[model samples]
Target chain A: MATISIEHASKSFGATEVLKDISLDVKDGEFLVLLGASGCGKSTLLNIIAGLEPIAEGTIRLDGEVVNDVHPKNRDIAMVFQSYALYPNMTVERNIAFGLEMRRISKAERKATVREVASMLQIEHLLARKPAQLSGGQRQRVAMGRALVRRPKIFLFDEPLSNLDAKLRGEMRTEIKKLHQSLKATMVYVTHDQIEAMTLADRIAIMKDGVIQQIGTPQEIYSKPANMYVAGFVGAPPMNFVEVDLVKQEDQFGVILPAVLKGEPKNYFLPLPDSKQLETRENTKIILGLRPEMITHNAFTQSTNPEIECDVDLLEPTGADTLCLIRLAGHPAKARVSPLFACDPGESMTFSVDMGRVCLFDGETEELIRL
Target chain B: MANPKTLPGANGKRYLFGRLFIWTLLLAAAVLYLGPIYVVLSTSLKDLAEIRAGALLDLPHELNFTAWREAWSSACIGVRCEGLRPYFLNSVIMSVPSVAISTLIGALSGYALSLFRFRGANIIFALMLFGCFIPFQIVILPMAQTLGYLGIANSITGLIVVHTIYGISFTTLFFRNYYVSVPQELVRAATMDGAGFFRIFWHIMLPLSVPIIVVSVIWQFTQVWNEFLFGASFTSGGSQPVTVALNNLINSTTSVKQYNVDMAAALIAAAPTLVVYIIAGRFFVRGLTAGAVKG
Candidate 1:
């Protein structure tokens, strides 16, 4: 296992900087995923960590040894590219054994290792076939097997499943997770697929415009995104932001939320949690972040939790949960309700907001105001 | 069902006639191209008296290897009459080393230009491509001077050096264009596998280079074999290649033009390239088309 520490790394191509002041430390055996959209420097960062690309600034350490000047082969790392990057001319057996052969391993030992890796990947039946003959899923497995057979100090994966179909992507994703679990090798995966990031990463580093926005556990990123970008980027049905005016209700502080009742828009006081940020921001505008699941189709009776009756502008049923779009404070927001909840478009319904899970951000800076 | 053949408005008949006519034209064209070769073969097999008396297309009354033997051993080339045999060997010696050395270095250089990202790499490749456009006539004077300075002027080694230098740009172009389609990930994968530059080229790049190699080999072979300018300009006498020898054999003033002997020598000079094309012709086309289409 290896611990990768990237300190203040920056990379510039010509005049444009692709990675700016990036620092990340991956613990031993932890599966860290660099997640971002295209041109966000996620792939560039992964290439830097793999030593495929050189860094213009800062140093990279693999297991406490500075490896910035080391050749990729000497870094003791193997990477699975998004394209699978299987040596096309070599058969599955030779492809797996090539690394061993290069290391001057004995012929018999290379064969045995290849056989073991082939069987582990369940590609033994395909050992004689070339890469062109394999299906997309099989190629992905072979790519993984190539990385696995080496058993390097670290494994780097650059969107290894992005080329597969949806069904195969899911299967290969689980296989990768299982492989990581069994081997417990330090893996740094890069992908823009948030679901892949969410399900596979021990810690997800959300990046944007060559900068790391936040690096934390998946749950931490989901529940407490550092800013508006992370909050909107991580979830499938992204977090909804509503412009609200903070007001004081005697000793209590809350926002005046617009709700629809009896086919008419009306104002309701949604009490904010008791916090210094809220008190300081009273009488000023702030952005409120709410997840789809945090608001559900439920009737509030005794609880003092904030609830609103709004018209369902649109309804989307996704087998397990039906997402109902409603307007809240002049912006469209998604509310996740059970599929059995009979909500129709243009009909009014009550959605209970979990006030404890709500996030408040400074109006101008867009950074979360933690209290 | 209708009687399809007779029930038609004669369109099927017209279609058959059209196809037949096209085939007839293709056959006529094929014969037109092969007609000269047939004459050369027939003439080379006949006695000089018969060749002079009979029409070019007439069949020889007696097929013989007399001219072939004379051309291979004792036909006159200039005053020596040592025939084209020594010059044939000279051409073989020159072409083989030229093709091998140029192709090897070209493949390595092409792999570097295609896969590696070093500073000035593209500038170097651009310079080499500029070599492809430098007409031989434009540099022959400088080349002769250089060869004389190196003490290889008028020598077989000088001819080999000239052909190799001239062949590199084409060979490099062939291999580079063909290898550009190869993914850089393969190199990265090899590098990660602890395979260094030469190791990667040997283990990975060379294995995948067969088609392009055949293309390069055939190209260099044909070019160096048929090359009269450099062979004639760089060397003379016994060191001259078979093409230069063939010209001298046909142009000798000491004897009457021995058409049969000259024809035999000409065919012998062209034999190796003919055999190469007939053997690896398909791969040549494949390489060309592969280079044409982008991945």
Candidate 2:
């Protein structure tokens, strides 16, 4: 019900800036995730939005009314912490009713609210149980129940599911998505987990250092990362950056892999589509971005591709799939292959670079090129 | 380390031997510590003449309640011979309130420091921590003058306040360190759930910090109860704590040495804390062990 705005916001610790000239908006009923690694100030920004931390310079507005100086309790926003921070002493029912009690709501209404929230979260049977009595997932539910009872205008989650085991984390992630869909509450979630960002966010704000690298839908960030940082950070087994020189091959500009593959120690040429119009540029140093999945277990050519025959240096089995690390064009690169592929060290595997999906980045600037 | 379950009867043998050794050492330590207390109790039931013979470890050949009656009613330390019970009562009134108030305030303050980030909070915590390390005697003169200014000098309330003030540092430190271990999320959850400062402190923080509070109470009680200098300096005979009365009764400058009566008064002064420790011994040990392990 509330749209949160951070207008020209900045935060600092002493002289070191944590968030610099940052501005973001959480539209009414939007699920916006501030996604970044630790120390990237995503949590700081979330805390700023929650009125938990003061900014060095910024005005935050909720629903167009400035809330820069509002105390957190009066801001009508509830937060679910990563730690599940359920009051250890209080039973689940009391924990849920705490907000209502704080507002001096009538006991009858508070009880009803607690019951409603508990059942909604599937924690009703746990009403009389203390936090210690509950499992991690149950504690998580209590934390959510504690927040949901208030019917706050905005919901802030600071990596709420980061504490759960993998299976539980996935379940809760789905539950959160479902909860968001049903309630349509304006939520600002901060997380380092890209999976959470991808699954839960309406828009993902990917940040680096103190600056945002990109802000867009999950598809946009994954498909069209603005920089090398985003390209690498948003993917697991990450995006491979092969050092290359852009050269002109005949009539078209081509990217030159700087080194050889296997016993043939020479460059392989791959031409670029020239929206860049620089496909014919000679010896242009750049990096080619290829996601591990894009370079697959299948044959190198369903279409004529930028193919490289490389030595599979290492293979990691993650039960679901195998991650093959290969030395291609003299640089270490990783590829996600199907578990059916029996990959081993010291063997050559032909990796198909999906030229259509490949990203070109300026070598020195690390900025993605349109080509 | 051999697997415990696979060790056959080794566990039972070990347990029995360990108990025997531990009990033996415990008995030795008990005798060593309570040796003086035993002498005091036994000799306090003897006449002055028997005490003069100083057969220190002997059972009193002749038993007498004369000393107990005299110590409670007629052992003159000053112009009044109405023994140390008045001072004993004064000490109880002082120590009990002092410990309770100081521990409660310290718990709340420590909870605040641990849970919240406010301007100058760290600096305030550092100052409070430093407050605990300074010798209590150093603050006695200024504290007395301040109490006098507030018109409570030489009063029990004055002593209680002073003791509570002095006790704040360790109590705060104890509570703060313990509260720090409590997950910050719980406090945040409580706050987000609309519980304000005092509500969070009482309902959320304090209830979860029981072991630390027990630890704090036991520590503060022992400290405040036995505080001789504060008791002696702050009040004269009528308002003095039992330590002062015990000192006056045992070490009277102008009176003949009455060992039996003196011992009886010492025993009386020591009784409350001894009784308290015995009653709450399990909690005290639990609190202390938990505090040490965590800290």
Candidate 3:
């Protein structure tokens, strides 16, 4: 296993900059997931690591040796493409044996390796058939088997499970996880699915516009997001944001929430713990970032006072949990509640918002509040 | 591809009627296309008088080998009145090398253009496409002079070179478009597996491309086999292609036109391409549908 270090890598296709000043260090034996939207340079970054794409600037080092000048084949890396680009003319067995044959391995040994990987991926019965005769998931297994036969130092997977159906994708995801665990090989997987990123990665790198927004473990990114973008992108059903003014009413500091008090919504106040920063920053706006699960149907006994007194506007039942939309402080918010407390769409219900689990962000800068 | 139960009309009678109508129409078309060839073959086996009467649609009185005799030897091409055997050999020698060399160059150029992304690859590809689609008459004058300057004028080798040069662009265009239809990931995967350019092409790309190769061979053979303008312009008597000999045999003002001999010579001249079509006819259609039809 070798660590791959991308130092200030950048790529541009004519006038369009695809990747910019992107640097990442993938540890040895680490499953690093580059997570982003379709055009967010994740695949381009993976291609650079695989030596398939040339970067405009900076060097890539593998195992402390600069490998920017190395050719893809010489770099000793294996890759699985989303299309599962199996050789249509060759049988599945030959497809798996191709890399080994290219490396000039012995025929008997190649056969053994092919059988091992075929059984591992449960594609043994498909060995005699060409790719055209196989189904989508079977082709994907052959593609993975082709890569696995190489036993290269590093592995790159470019949306390996994207082509399969939902059930097959889940099955392949588990298989890939098991394969990585058994092999303990350095792998860099590129994907747009946050769920895949959360499950498969040792360290998830959430990217946007060619820059990395956050890089940490799944739990770390979920619990403490670096900014509004990271907080909004990682979670399903998303986090809720509401504009509120930090006000000091007497000896304590509180968030001045907008609510329907007099005619239209008024800036009603909610008391918070006394803080040096929040007490003096009156009239200054701060956004509250709270996940749907944080503001639940359970009682809010952890905070000194509840700031969000709101009515449920909509109910979205998702099997085990029901997602309820609430109008709190004149802004729409979402909360996750157990099916036990699930109410009808128009029911008048007030949820005790848990203030202790809320995140504060500077409204103008879109950055997290230090306090 | 259709199940009988799901067939149109859902009745055996209608299906049989449909099949009969299609067969009748196909038979009529076959008769229309092969009618002249039958007439030519008949006259080639007829005597001079029956041919002169132009009663070609009628059956010959009896089989005769006189036209084949005159067409092969002792017929006036100029003052000599010799046969077309030399001209037939000339055509074969010229067309075979031209087809082989041109197809090879085209397949290689097409492979490179389709797979590799060098700096000027696109520009070269566009120019080659432009070259293929232009009228040959527009460039023949300069091309002939260039061959003359190289001192292969009035020679069969000169004619072969000219045909090869003119055929390159079209051949390359065919193979390039065919290669484009091939999954590019195959090439990428081969590259990742440590196969070099030629290795990948020979081992992966070309093996999977027999259909296109058959198509290229058929198209280039037909094109070179029937080429008249280049053959006429490139060489004079004693060095002319079979088409040139046929022209000379029919163009004499005082000499009587021998229709029977002319048909035999023309059919003989077209025999190679016809035989090739018989061998690879299905593959040609398969290649077009496979390469051009969308997913």
Candidate 4:
């Protein structure tokens, strides 16, 4: 219902800059997620948007109206904190209705809104209970109900599911997605968990050291990361990086990946897609990034995709897929394979490399090479 | 570690001896502390003749209400024969407002100091803490002059003002430490909920402040009720607190001495504080420890 535009936003604590000159635009009804590890300033960015923290320099516009000095409440936004910051002394009913009360709404109207939100969250039976009496998941639901009761133009969530257990985290993540879909409200969520960001965000902004590395759809970021940092940060058993020599032979550009097969050293040349950018970098070292799923036991249909035999160093079973750690160009790389086709430790396995989806990065800059 | 059943008999004997020694020391300390209360009670119930004839720790021959009545309504302090009655009322009037005003202000100050971030917050807190260590004697002359300038000198109002001002430092210290353990997110959420400063304090901060409130009330009440120097310095005659009256009752020049009346009046003055502690003693310990451990 509202769009957030942050232009040249910068913040610092003492001498250490926590948020550099950051510019981001969140479209109306778009679920934008700021994803990064701790100290990357994702939470600080959320606070700045919430008006809980002030920016050193820059202006924030909501719905194309300047609101740099406006208070958070007047900006028509509600935030769900990671701690579930429900008023410990108030009942679930009051906690949800408190905002309306603060705005001087009538008691009867407040009660009705509380009922509607409680039913939507399936927490009607818990309306009379205090926060102390609820479980972690129940408290999380109450927090969401409180935000929903306000029906603000935008909703801000700061790692709202981080305090829940893994199973509860998954359930609440789905609930949040459902809430966003049903309400079509603008949301800016901050989290360090990549899975949450991947499943929930319409567009993910991956940040590092106060600078945003990439902002794109989950598919775009996963398949085409802007830099080596975004590539490694977004995947589970994260994307593997191997240094290889890019060479041109017979008018074709490819990278030579040294591998160990059955205690013997070998080299596999995986051809790169035709690009003028690749031609200029021939006979030079480049970093090749490959996702685990891209290197699997299944054979590729295309003749261009190369297959390499590798010695499996370790096996990690994750229910449906077992990950086999293998050496690619003398660096340990993870390859995802079906549990049925997975090879045990100290055995040889052939993994087909999907050359079409591989990423090539500059050795010195660590930035992705366009192709 | 050896099991008790497998241990030697000498160890059992040593354990018994140790427990006996500990119990003896504990009992002795308890008697030493309670010994004065026994003397005061016994003396208050005795007539002058019996008090002269009996030992200090001796039990009264029979219960008597004469001295109690005399202390309540008819004893002479200075030139006043109104006993401790009016002075006790003066103390209640002075202490109640002083405790309430000081505690409420302290809670507000504490809430601001602990939760709100502003320029020079730490420096302000440091100054207030410095206020706690300032001796009453050091400020008496200046305070008296200020009270005179304000036209409340030598009255119960002046004493009330004095006690409240002096009590703020300790009460603020107690409440501020307690409020720090509360999460900062609660305030942020309340702010986002459209609750302003006073609204948040009334709904969120005050409700969660019961334990600390009890602590502050007990602390300020006891201090104000027992204070003697300010009560004596700032007030005279009809406006003097019970402590001043009790002093005059015991130390007044008289041939007979009236030991029973002095004992009864002293007990009457100390009774309110004793009762306050007995009722809220458990919470005092709990609140102190609760503030000690940071959340």
Candidate 5:
């Protein structure tokens, strides 16, 4: 296992910069994922680490030794491509042994290693078949087997499961997670699929516009996002934001939401928690970020937490939970409620807001407000 | 469309008539193509008296081997009575080595052009393609002088060099167009696997080149075998190819025109190319169409 440290790596094509001043470190035996949308340069960064693409202005180190000038084969790394990039002319056994053969390993050793990798990937029965004859999932297994036979210091996967169908993708994702667990090899995976990043990464580095926005554990990224982009990108039914004026209500600073129920408008007060950032900010506009699950149908206490009665504009039932859409402060907000709650459209329902889980952000800068 | 095998017997007459029309057209096309070849073969088997007595379309009363035997050993061309044997050997000696050397160089050049990126690569490819548009007659004089400078003038080696140089532009075009369809990722993957330039080419690229090689070989064989201008201008006597020898035999005014011997010698000169085309006909078409559409 190797620790990969990238220091201020920047890349550009012609005049347009594709990666700008990016720095990241992957610990030994750690599974780190670079997550972003298309053209965010995550794939380019992975290529740079794999020595497939050249870096413009920074140094990369593997296990504390500079590898800026090393070739990919000499870097002790193996890569699995998104297209499964299997050699079309070779049989599955030959494809797995190609790297070993290139390294000039003995024929007997190559055959034994091929058998071991095939059995590990459960592709032994497919040894005689060509890549074109295999199905999509089978091709993915052969690709992984080709990488695994080398047992390189690091494994680079470039969206290895994006080509499979939904069910197969999930299955392969779990299989990859298990493979990482058993082997404990350092792997740097690149993908635009957030669910893959959330499920498979030890740490997720969210990127946008060729810059790393945040690098944290999945739980940290999910519960305490660093910026507005991370908050909006990580969750499925994304976090809701409403513009509110911070006002002093009797002894506490809070915001009021205008809710409509039964053709009548009511003002509901949501008191801000005791934080140093909220001091001396009265009469100023701020944004309140709330997750969908935080606002639900359960009412815990009448006096401690704030509750709003609003008309449900839409309901989407996903069998496990139902997402209810309601209007708050003149914008659409989604709230996740249990399917047992049984709410519908055009009806008024009383929902409780989890005041402890709310996040406050600066309206102008879109940065999370914290003490 | 309905399945014809499952159709009723009552529809058989209409199907028969449609097939009959197609067969009639095909028969007319075949005769149109093969009529000249048939005349040459039949003429080569007849005596001078039979030629004067009968129409050109009439079959010989009795087949004669005298014309074939004479063409093989004793037909006269330019003060040499020794038939087409030597000139035929000269063409073979020229074509075999030329095709092999030109095809190897073409494969290497095509591999480099398709896979490697360097300054002015596209300009180089464009320049090579320009060679295809130049007519052979335009370069005959300058080429003869160049052969003289190389000290291979009027020799079989000189003809081989001339054929190889001219044939490279076409063979390179065929292989380059064909290799362009191979994915660049294969090369990248091979590089990452520690396979250098030549290893990847030998193991990965060459195995996949059988069809295009067949196409290149057949094309080069036909062109070099039939080439008369360069052979006549650049060489003399025993070094001239069969095409030039045949031309001299047909036009020689020193002896009475032996039409039977002339026809037999011409057919003998044309046999190798005909055999090549017949053997590699399918691969030739496949390689041509694939190179055109994909590249």
Candidate 6:
């Protein structure tokens, strides 16, 4: 396995710059995912690492060797494309064996390697079939087989599971994770799917507009996002942002949250944890970021957690948990509570707010106010 | 609910009348198209005496093979009594090489143009497309001079060269349009698989090009086979293609015109293309519409 290092890489297509000065390092045998929305240059970075796209400026080193000018073939990298990109004209056996044949491996060895890969992918029966004859999941297996047969130093996947149905995608996701654990091969996967990144990556690099917003473990990114963008982009139902007035009450800093309870206007003061960052920002407007699960029904509360009574504006039942909509500081926000404890819409309900985990961001810059 | 059988009596009668009218028009059109073929077949089977005595549309008194044998063996064309056999061989030699060379070159160029991005690619493709619109009559003089300079003038090779050059523009257009619809990811995957330029082309692009290849082969063959201007202008005597020889045979000023022999010679010259169409006509239609929609 090889470690990939891309330093200050910049790419552009004519006048439009696709990848700005981006630097990233992937550890040996680590599964690193480049996660972002479309047009965020995650795929472009993957292509750059694969040596498929030329970098306008920067150095890319593989295994501590500068391979900026190496061809993709000589780079000893194998890639699985989102479309599978299996040679439609070749049978599965030949498709998986093509790289070995091109490398001038012996015919017998190539056959043995292909057979081994086929069995590993559980596609031995599909060896004689062309790609067109395979189902979506089967084609994905063959694509992986093609990559695995090479035993390359680095494996690149360009959103390989994006084309599969939801159920198939999950099964393949687990299969890929298991493969990674078993093989311990360095892999760089690019996708816009946060769930895939969270489940499959050892560390996820979240990008936006050609810049990396955050690069950390999935839990770190989910719990302590680097900015408003990262905070909003990571979670399902997403993190809620409410504008609040930071006020000082007897040397304890708190945020004034305006809410309507049972059709009556009420202002709640949610105290913030003591921090030098919040001390300097007293009496200033700031954005408070609260994850949905941080606010829950009162039954699952700690005595230390502050409580707020607000009218439930709407209710969205999602099997295990029901997301209730409530106004925080006059802005709508969602709170996750057990479906059993959710109240009907338009009724007042008490919610325990975990102020300890709330993220405070600069109102103007939108950068998180770290505690 | 509105089935024709379930319609009111008046509407049903109107529907039947409309169907009958369309059938009559279709039959008339079919006859108009096939009428000349019937006449040619009848004339080719008639003896000279029968031709003089019977009506043009009448069946021959008996099937006669003399005209066919004469057309194949000894019909005089431009004072050469060796008939269309040599000219037929010349057409075959010219069309086969021309079609194969033009199609191969076009496929390679098409593969490069559609998949590889380089400076001046579109300009080069646009110029090649521009060559397709240039009229054949406009290039005859320059083409003849080039052929004479190459010292292949008045030979099958010279005609092959001319047809191949003229055919490249069209063949390239056909293959380019077809290859453009192919996904670029296939090439990228192959490249990552350690296959280089020509390997990717031979292994991936070519195997996937069957439909377009059939289309190109049929188009170039038909055009080169029936082409008269280049054949007539560039070659003569022994090296002239079948179309030129057929013209010479029909236009020769004999003391008495032999309609049976002329008809037989004409049918012989047209037979190869007719056979090709009959065998591969379905593929030609399929190949034309192959890339019009995504799978």
Q: Of the candidates shown, which would achieve the greatest DockQ relative to the real structure?
A: 6
Clashes of each: 0, 5, 2, 0, 0, 0
Candidate 2 lDDT, B1-295, residue by residue in tens: 9787777766677778988999999999999999988888898899978888878899998788888888877777777778887888898899899999989998988888877867898899999999878997788889988999999989999999898888899888888887777776666666666678888887877777777787788888888888899888889969999888888887773546788887887787888888878877778777766742210
Better of 3 and 4 by DockQ: 4
Docking class of 5: acceptable
Candidates, ranked, DockQ: 6, 4, 1, 2, 3, 5
lDDT, candidate 1, at A58: 98
Report how large a share of the reference interface contacts model 1 reproduces: 0.69
For model 5, what is the C-alpha lDDT against the true structure? 0.88
* Residue A194 Cα positional deviation in candidate 2, in Å, after optimal superposition: 1.6
DockQ of each: 0.52, 0.47, 0.46, 0.59, 0.33, 0.62
Q: Candidate 2 lDDT, tens digit per residue, A117-212?
A: 888888889999888788889988888887899899999998888878999999999999999999989998999999899998999999888898
- Residues A214-273, model 4: lDDT tens digits: 999999999999999999999998999999999987788999999899988899988888
| Cα lDDT of model 5 by residue, A1-371, tens digit | 59999999999987989999999999999999999999999989999999988789999999999999998889989998887777877899998899999999999999999999999989999999988899999999998998899999899999999999999999999999999999999999999999999999999999998999999999989888888888899988889988888888898888887777886877899987877678867888988889998788864434567888899989999889899998888889998898878477889888989888787778888888874
- List where candidate 1 sits over 4 angstroms from the true fold: A259-263, A299-302, B1-32, B291-295
Give each model's whole-structure lDDT: 0.89, 0.83, 0.83, 0.91, 0.88, 0.91
Q: How much does each candidate deviate from the true structure in C-alpha RMSD?
A: 2.9, 4.0, 4.4, 1.7, 3.5, 1.6
lDDT digits (tens) for residues A1-371 of candidate 1: 59999999999999999999999999999999999999999999988988889989999999889999998988889999888878877898998888889999999999999999999999999999999899999989888888988889899998898889999999989989999999999999999999999999999999999999999999999999999999999998999998889999979888888866666888988887788767667799899899998888775333666778888989999989899988887778899998877477888888888888888888999999897
Q: Which candidate, 1 or 4, has the higher TM-score?
A: 4
The candidate 2 chain A region of ten consecutive residues with least summed lDDT is A273-282
Q: For candidate 2, list the clashing residue pairs, or say none.
A: A85-B185, A246-A284, A253-A279, A253-A280, A274-A277
